[model samples]
Each structure stands twice: as structure tokens, then as C-alpha cells.
Target: MQTTGISYSETSVRGRSRPSSFRQRFKHSASWLKGVAVALTLGSLLSGCGVVNHMIYKTTGDVMQGFSRDHTIPYLMASGDLAMGCAMSEATAPLLMSFGRVTNEPDQLAVMLYLSAGGCAEEQGREHELAALAAMYERKGNAAEDAIIRQKRAYSLAAKRYLKGWQHHNTYYGEPGTGECPDFDDDMDEFIYFAGLLAGLQALNSEIQSTSSIGVPKNVGSVVARASSCLESDKWWGAPMALKATVWAMIPGAQPEGEDAFERLAMTDRMGDEAGVRLSHVFHAIAATNKGDEAMVKSVVRQHAESLKEQPANEDWAFVDAMATNMIIAISDRLWVENTGHRTPLGRLGTFWDDQKAEVETMDLDGLL
Candidate 1:
């Protein structure tokens, strides 16, 4: 209803090279509306609510299968596809890069480039440029100093260009803090939340770890704070709430209020309440990572496990299962590290628990005890 109210049927001739008369435009609009009416009538007559319900059941069943070792690649790939499918343009590249690419989507290229510029990749093409700046700062020569300054200028200019271009072409939320984020014009808040989280996380990971020059610790920290505020205000119903909570847990010293937003939803006992169930895992993960109260984490996870076990597994439930399973594994790994020097009660956590070394090597993160 909110989205429908905001939908202003734009004149078809507006974006065209040749303009049309008001009468012609009105006729075209009428034809389009008539076609929509016919399509809806045919759809309702053919299937009814049963058909719609069945489709909903199928979609839910598919989404609830979370990530496990056997399906890590597939899960990540599918999440990537969904992210890209929902993305309207290149401005959303920061989030798109979270999952690796499959095909050559045009929007993906800019996302990749942004990552390269920020040193998100190992062999980024822009690494040479970054290194050149480093070399200039390292030496005592005029040309070298000039080169470093020029490189800095170039990077800044490119970023400004991208921001301006995104503002001009993007139909969704424009650059944050342009007074564009608060506008309730559409149901694309999911996309907005995803993008904001991606950007905020990018800034945090890069700046906090000292891997990037563009983001400073103070700046990244503030970004996280802002993101948490945005996420809280956004219209997250289920899994989106769990996902946002998971990201919020990663923010250092972040303690946002309204942790009970998901509970307000009148979710049925069906696995369609995946967000509610999946949130338990996030709570556990937060408690594990931050070395917070263990009792609270265990209580949430156990509560959900008991409830979820009673629910029927629908296709959409797969997404919830994957998310919960991954969170459990992550929490277990954290517990092992904290309790027994990275040794689990089951066994030495081997490949599954060895994220520390991988994260260090891949992201250049400091592995603090």
C-alpha cells in the first residue's frame, strides 16, 4: 500500500527522444492499464488463492535452506544471484561484491572496480597505482612526492564522479546524507538497507584493519553507528531483521536499542517465521564474538531450536536453516577458541574452525587473542 501510493504513473513520452501529444499519452496509459486488468483477470481465474499459496510455500521452502559445508559455494552463489537480481543498477556494487560473480552483469563491473580501488582484492589492477603512491611517500624525491599527491587527487576525483553519477541515474535512495535516505517512496528499503550495510561494513573492515587509506577508524566507526540507526528505522520484517542484527553485532561497541522489533510481528508457528528462528543464531554469534554473557546466547539458540524442531520444513525454510546452521557453526568455533585454545570438545576444529588464519591471509586482519 505504501509503495502503491507513491507510484506516480510517469508519462511514457518523458524518457523518449520524440515527444507525444497529451491525447496520445493518455491513450497509451489506458491501453497499458487495460492489459494489466486483463492479465490479472486471467491469472485469478486460472489459479485462485490456492495457486498463490502454493507458490509462496515453494519459495519459502527454497529460501530456508541455509549454508552448510556441502552447500557453501552454492549458497553463496545463490545469495549473490538474489542480490544482483534485486539490484537496479551499478550504484549497488558494494553489496554485490560481497558474493563473488558468476556472469558478467554490467552493474557488477563498477562494484569490482570500486573494490579494486579500495584494495579489496589481492591482485587489483589499481594496486600498481596504490603502490606508486606508497613509493612516492617512501622516497625523498620531488617527482615521487608529486606522484603520490596526484594519485590521491585522482582517487578523490574518481570517487566524486561516481557519487555524482549514481545520484543522477539511481532511482532508489541517493548518496546517504543527501536527505534522500528518509524518503518513504518505495518498498526498496531492503535494497537500501543492504547497500548501507555493505558500504558500512566495507569501511569498517578496511579502516579498522588498516588495509585501506580511504577509511579511517574514527570514520568507519561512525559509519557503523549510522548504519545501525538506519537498519533500526528501516522496515525489516523477518530474515532481514536477523541479517541486520547479525551485521550490527560485528560493530565494535555497538549497542542499539529496540532489539525486540522482530517479536512484534505476528508470525505463525510455520517455518515462515524463519527470521525469528534465525535471530537466535545471531544472538549466539554476538555473544560468542564479543565474549558477552554466554547464558543469554545459549538461551536464545535453545529456545529457537525447540520451537523450530516442531515446525514443518517448507522449501523457503531452507534459507533459515542455512543461516542458523552457519551461525551455530560460527558460535561453536568461537567457543572452542575461547575455551580451549581453538580446540573443540568434539576434536581439533581443523578446516572448519581455521577461519583465523584464512581471515588474516585474505583480509590482512590482525589475529588478536
Candidate 2:
């Protein structure tokens, strides 16, 4: 037979015959190997030097910005927890600033970075102010003077940082460079816009606290009032309410008819509790202190302390929570220092009133007798 010269298996795989299944499998395996090789080569090329880390930071920052814009920010605003929000911004400052340094583009991330840095500077300014108070209480002549000088430097630093943030916001938003008020469309936009406003207000506050005269426009209150009306009272967790109340308390004849400042301040507590953030209470406490209303200040502080015990700051917003606690603790510390010549006792920041030993009145009266 003619098939005697060829094996049956070889003859079966001759011209026009299907290839063996093993051969097909091997071909597929080879193709897959080539594909994997190409992928690895491309990956190596893309991951060269700082490219990977830069891309990672960029992507992460973008995701975080989106998260903050959509979820975290709205929740924080509605909860009146801007302290935590500020803390969030502050925590991401280094990453954001580093990104800004690498790129010259003025994107939202850049604006946020500047704002966060500005907020941190403002907080540091407040810290310096507290140190000044502490030094003044110490009754050390040159020490108080040195503290005052440091406080002034901090205030100046805060003003510069805030101005930079405002300028960045204005530039990115296509607004006037003179720090003129800008408009916003949605809640996120409004929140960012308000941050610029707060930055300006902080600068003014620092200047005022330092007893230095800056060229802030006299019509700043009118601008703030106009912008305050744009904020949705329900969505913003009574931030507008607290701000208006503060304005009324600070400025002469600013309170509207039939609207009491203290009552408006009280309303913030209710709204703040519903939003799970009570930063408005801090604002109210500050106003009360400025007004020399010791009773109101004590009541506000007590309420803040009790609220903290009942509900601690959310872990997701840990930085913000810490900031809120720190702010209130600072207020308490000031009160303690003014009264007892010391700071709030260890681990007793929010619960300063609970410790009888720390009370100024409890100090040994027998020694005086």
C-alpha cells in the first residue's frame, strides 16, 4: 500500500488536515507569552524614575479631590464640621503642595493646597496668639514682649498665606485679582468660594488680633452678608447662620429686625448636632468671649464638653475631629489660664470642668488665710 511509507498519525495531519490540538495549545501559549513580554516592557518603560510616583500622587490627589468634593466635603459642611474639613485640607497640604510645585497649572487641587496651607497658617497664628496670652499671664516682662512679637509675626505669616490662597482662588475661578467676591454654581463650588471668603476673614481676624491696621475694605461686612445669602442654610449645616450671628455680634447694628444674635447662635447648636459637627459652638464661644459674657462662654463650653462625651468625632474624619477638639480645648485652655494660671489638665481637655482639682476656685484658700 502507498501508506506503508508514512505513519498513520503523520498521514492524518497532511495537507488540508486540521492541526493537532496540542499544537494549537502551544501556539496559544506562545502568543500569550509574547503578550506578557510586551506588557512587562511597556510597564517598565512607564514606571521609569519618578514617573510612577508622580502619576500615583496625581491620580491619588485627583481621587481624593473628587471624594472630598462629592462625599466628605458635603457631609462635613452639612454637619457644620469645617474644623475637620480644615484638618482634612491641612493633612493633605504637603502632598498637594508638592504636586503644585511639579506642575504650574492652576487646577482645583492647587487651589485646595493653597487654601489648606493658608488655614494651617491661620491656625498657627491662633496658637501664637494663645502663647502670647500665656506669656502675658506669666507676668514676665521681656517674655510677654517676645511672645507679642512672635504673635505678630505669626499673624503676618497667616495674612500672607491667606492672601495667596485668595489670589489662587480668584485666578482659578476667573474672578478679579483684588479679592472681589466670586459666584458659584453648586454646593461644592459654594463651599470652595466660601473658603476664600473665610481666608479673607481669617486674615482680617489675625490683623485685628495683632492690633495691626491692614488695608481691608470697609465694605467687607456687606460683601460677606451678600455672599452669606447664597449659602443654603439647610445644606450648609447652619454655617451661614453662625456666620451671620457672629457678624451681628461683632458689628454694630448688623443684627436684622426680630433676629437675636444669641438666639441665632443657639440655633447653630441644633443644626450642628443634626449634621454631627458642632464647630459653630466654637464660633459662638468665641463671640461670647469677645462680648465679655462669661456666663454665655461657660454655657457654650459646658455644652461643647458634654456633646463631645456623648458623641466623639467620626474616625473617617479623624483629622477634622482632632481639630475640632483642639479648637475647643484651646478655648478651654485660655479660660483656664486666665483663671487658674495654667492650661487644661492632662487628658481633661474637653472635660476640664469635670476635674475639681483643676478649678481655679478650688486652689487652697487656707494658705491665703
Candidate 3:
């Protein structure tokens, strides 16, 4: 007998069909710091750069250093937000490998995508910091050359990391030994597109932040092409499933032509769509984008904050929302910070910690469900 709900695996909806079994089927499918002694030894090594003996950790290591180490790792492991934290860390694994860290998690490939998304965030943050860095250099006129070099280095880092993220993502998980990703799962596609969106945003952010503007990175083009391919095939199902695709649709250069556009995309199923007022805010945030809708954005963000407070144990959804919320909040915060220099506590939290707070918050879900 056919299950009552609309099948998640189906590409398109005829009208109002029951939700799919795959939603629950795949739903079932569902990182460590060094020791203190190891910490002391590494700290001494990281203190200096010029010496060959200098202990250079990975790009992640360096960035992580600026935050509160004790709290960061634990925070990332929390529930509902675990996938995002894993994704963020996995993205930087390649760079971290250069520093001699090793990761062999069963879900390494999936984690890689999430981590890459996180890395994209890091790259943008660095770009935003560049304008400030350049101004500082100008004031210290004596070190103008040094400032230029630093900016170049920063740009290169963002570009390089972005490119690497693109490489791992392009395989479509088709790479041998990565796991069996025959075709693409709708849920999987949801996460993949999220990563791609983050990548595209990073590319745009780089251009916006740079002293000399460059055209969008090739990865942006690749991502857009892939997203178009997904839509043309009608590869996703339901509202939540469609949200990622809809988000991609909004990307500046995603598709040259499309019917319905925002209205159609907004109509798709959204997870937690029935969760009442809590979800209204979430949906509002998702829907408010690119419309110069500041009021909607703030409303959604505040609603999300309220939801998190009520359901401290909302590990599964919390983790999911963490990534979603962080992306919206991060971009929103950057714009406000860059243009107005005014920041809310959450925005400020992101700027100072590079999404660590969000990651740490997820850690609380570690053993929950």
C-alpha cells in the first residue's frame, strides 16, 4: 500500500499530498581538542611566526585561538545544531590537515560540506576585517607596504579556501569511497545547496570587501549551474525541502529566467512550518530576504532567539536552525556593522567569535536525542 503522505522522494507535488515516508526514513540516518599539556606546548610554538620551529596550527587553529577555547568545542557538539558544527569543522579539515590534524569520521563527506560552509563564513569575516585592517595600515603610514601585503594574504586565503570548498563539493559525493550518493537525496540536496549558497555569498562578500573588485568566483557560477540543474529536474520535494532551492533561486545570478520566482519558491514546504508562532518568525526570516525587508529580518531573528530560549532541549531543530539562523544573522550583522557600525549582541557575538557561539550552543545537544 502507498503511504498516505506525499512522498519526499517525489520530484513534484500534484496538489496537496501527504508528506513522504522518506522524511522519517532518512531522518533516522543521522570532534576533539588537544589536551592541556598539548595546549601549552602548542601555544609556545604559535607565539612566533618567522622561526622554522614556530608551531603553526591550521587556519582553523589560528582563527579558533581568538575565541574562548574551553567553551568552543563543547558548544559545537550541542543538538539540532550538531550537523552545522560538524559541517563547519569538516570544511576546514583540509587546511587543518596541513597542520597535522587527522579526521576519519564516518560522515566525513557530509561534515566536509558543513565545515566548508563555516569556512566561507570565516573568509567573509576576514574580508570585512580587511577594510579596518587597511585603515589601520594607513594611519601607521610607515608600514603601508606591510598593510598591502597583509591584505593580499587575506584575500588569497579567502579565495583559496573557497576554491577548496568548491572542489570537495563538486564531486556530488560521486568521488569513490565517499559513501553511496547515487543521484541525490532531497534532504541531502537541501544541505548541499545550503553549502553552495554559503559559498556563493562568500564569493560576493569577497568582491564587496576587497579594495579592488573582482568578478564573482567561478565557484559561484558552478553553484548556480548546479542549483539550476536541481530545479529543472524538480529534484526536491515539500516545503522544507524546497526552502534550500528557493534560497538558491534568490542568489543574484542563479537563473536568467524563471516563472513564479519568489512567490513560487516561498510557497514550498518548510520544516517546522506547523510549529506555530515560533515557526512564523523562522519563515518570516526566510521569506524576508532581498526585499530590503529589515523589519522582517529582525522579527525573524528575535523569534528564533525566543524559540531557542523556550526549547533549550531543542537539539535536533536547534542544530538545524543554528546554521540557518547564523547565516542570516551573520550577513545581517556584517551589513549593519559595515554600514552603520551598530550591532546587536548576537551580531557582535558572531563578529568576535566567528560563529563559535552558535557552534558551542549546539554542543549542549550532544547526548540529548
Candidate 4:
């Protein structure tokens, strides 16, 4: 009886040991699973930060792009302050451009901004050109050479900015006049397209002026000339025809026989004036300057000034009129500076330093004093 009791006790002990071993194995597995879960959670958190950052950056980029297209561009277009416009473009370009990393680039805005910035640099180049010319007139050989170098440097910078604008325009719109002009999303889109053409033309012009190999396409002039036809000359305030005409006048063999470039420019000048947008005068002056026809440039500037006096600027397009005025003034200033070693005097845009003084009886100022 004692032996049997001992055997039962042994069986009970074995059964208890089996359960204890099973519990130990289950506890170990649970602990392993917990550790794996913690590791995965930490890993996911570290990686998820990048994903979250990407999303946030993309959203911000999109918002900025939208705001620029909807509000900023229109405001700048409507404002007549060319200097302010230039400043705005230069100041905001880097911040705006950096957003391209996480989102689509604001290419249309880039076209306008770079174009404006290039204009600012071109203005500086013009100043240098005037200084160089004045130095030559004064027989200051070293000064003239130095001024020329400065002018070329400014022009090279202008060319690079303008070419960047042209590149962005091409990337956004594809080659202008691709199968046909791409359907413009709106009037603003059409305007942007027009701006792009101007950018390309300016790029080529500035590159030539720089006397540097800027890689601006030599064919850009012809391309712009052809692309100008895509815009309605009348609808865009005669700018398109003026651009085409300027290109025709500038490029060799570009003007179709019997279709006189100057004649077309004259017609467009009238069209521009009648439309209350005097942009055509700019083209006329540019063509005349390129031809070295100082008389014609003077005539164009005089006509523009007279037109301003006769007609109130179109309220809706006042900014464009103001831009034309600014460019004309720049040209007039160039002439004045070339002759007098200074820019045009206040309220003397139409008159030159050499203009004949109207016959006046000499007042004896000494006796009066």
C-alpha cells in the first residue's frame, strides 16, 4: 500500500512539472513579441517623420504657388511702379523657387519674375553703356574701357536671368507653336505665354550685348517672331504685332518682301495708341535704335509724349501704358545722356539738349537784379 501511494505521488509531481514548463515557454514567447513590437514602432516612427515632412512641404509649396498665380501676379501687373516690381521679383525669387523641391515649379511666375529682374539688370547695363560712351567722347581711354567692361558684365548677368526665364517658359509651355499654340488656360495664361516670348527675345539680345558666349540660342529671335503670331495683335494691345515687326526689322531676311517692317510698326503704333496702350511705341523706338536712325527714335519718343498728353491712360490698362512710358523715358534718357553726359532733365523728355531755343527777347537780368 505504501509503494502504490508513492507511485501516485510521483505521477502528480510529473503532471505539475509539465504545466510549469509550458507556462515558462508561453511567458518567453510573449516577451519576445513585445520586444519586436516596440522595435517596429520605433522604426516606423523614425521613417514616418520624412513622409510627414514631405506631405507638409508639398502642401506649403502648393499654397504658395496658388497665391502667387491668383493674387501676386495680378497685383504686380496692375501696379505701375517698375522699380517696385523689380524689387519684388528679385526679393521673392529664391524663396519661391526653393519650393520646387517638394512640388511643381511656379513656372509662369518665374517667367515674369526673371523677366522683370533681367530688365533691372539691363537698365544697369544701359547706364554703364552711357558712361562708356561719355568716357569715349571725353577721350578718357581707360575709363571708357572700364565702363565697357562693366556694361558687358551687367549685360551678361541680364542674359543669364533672361535665359533662365526662357528655359522655365519652354519647360512649362513646351516649344511655343508646338503643333499649334497650346490652348491658354485664360487671358492671364495667354499673357504669360507672351511674356515668355519676350523673355526669349531679350535673352538673345542681352547675350549679344554681353559679348559673351551665354548659350542663349541664336534661333530664339526667329522663334519669338513666329510665336508672336500666336497671340492676337489687337487683343493683347498691339504688342504681338509690334514684337513680330521688331523681330522682322532686326533679323536678316525676316521681313517678307513688300511687307515693310517699319510700315507695320507705324501701323501698330497707331493701333497701340488707339487702344490706349502705347506699347507699340517701344517697338518702334527699339527698331529705330537698332537701325541707328536717331531721327526716327526722337520722332517716336515725341509721338509717345504727345499721345500721353492727348489721351488719358486707359484706366484698366494704365499699368501697361505706364510701362511703355517708362521704357520710352529710358530711351530718351539714353539720348540725353549720350549728348549731355546726363539723363533727361525733369519735364524735358521730348526736348533734347541740342534743340533750338525759341527766339526770346533777351531780358536784361543784370539790371533787374
280: Cα error in model 3, Å: 12
Q: Tell me the tens digit of each residue's lDDT in model 4 across 170-265.
A: 999889755578778988899889889988999999999999999999889888988888899989878899999999999889998888999889
Tell me how far candidate 4 lies from the true structure as C-alpha RMSD in angstroms: 6.8
Best by lDDT: 4
lDDT of each: 0.40, 0.66, 0.45, 0.88
lDDT score, candidate 2, position 209? 63
Please say which candidate is ahead in lDDT: 1 or 2: 2
The number of clashing residue pairs in each candidate reads 17, 1, 32, 0
Error of 4 at 127 (Å): 1.7
How good is model 2 by TM-score?
0.65
CA deviation > 4 Å runs, candidate 4: 1-43, 358-369
Candidate 1, position 61, lDDT = 34
For 1-369, candidate 2 gives per-residue lDDT tens digits of: 365754333425347554467677999999999999999998888778468778777776666656655775556534545556667667865655565544444355445555556666666666665676777777766776776777777677666666666566556665433444456666568667666655556656766765766554455554565566656767765767787688788888888889888898899877765665676787788789879997788788778777777775544443444555567777888788766667888866554443467445567879999
Lowest summed lDDT across 10 adjacent residues in model 4 is found at: 5-14
Candidate 2 residue pairs in backbone clash: 84-320
Against the true structure, what is each candidate's TM-score? 0.36, 0.65, 0.43, 0.84
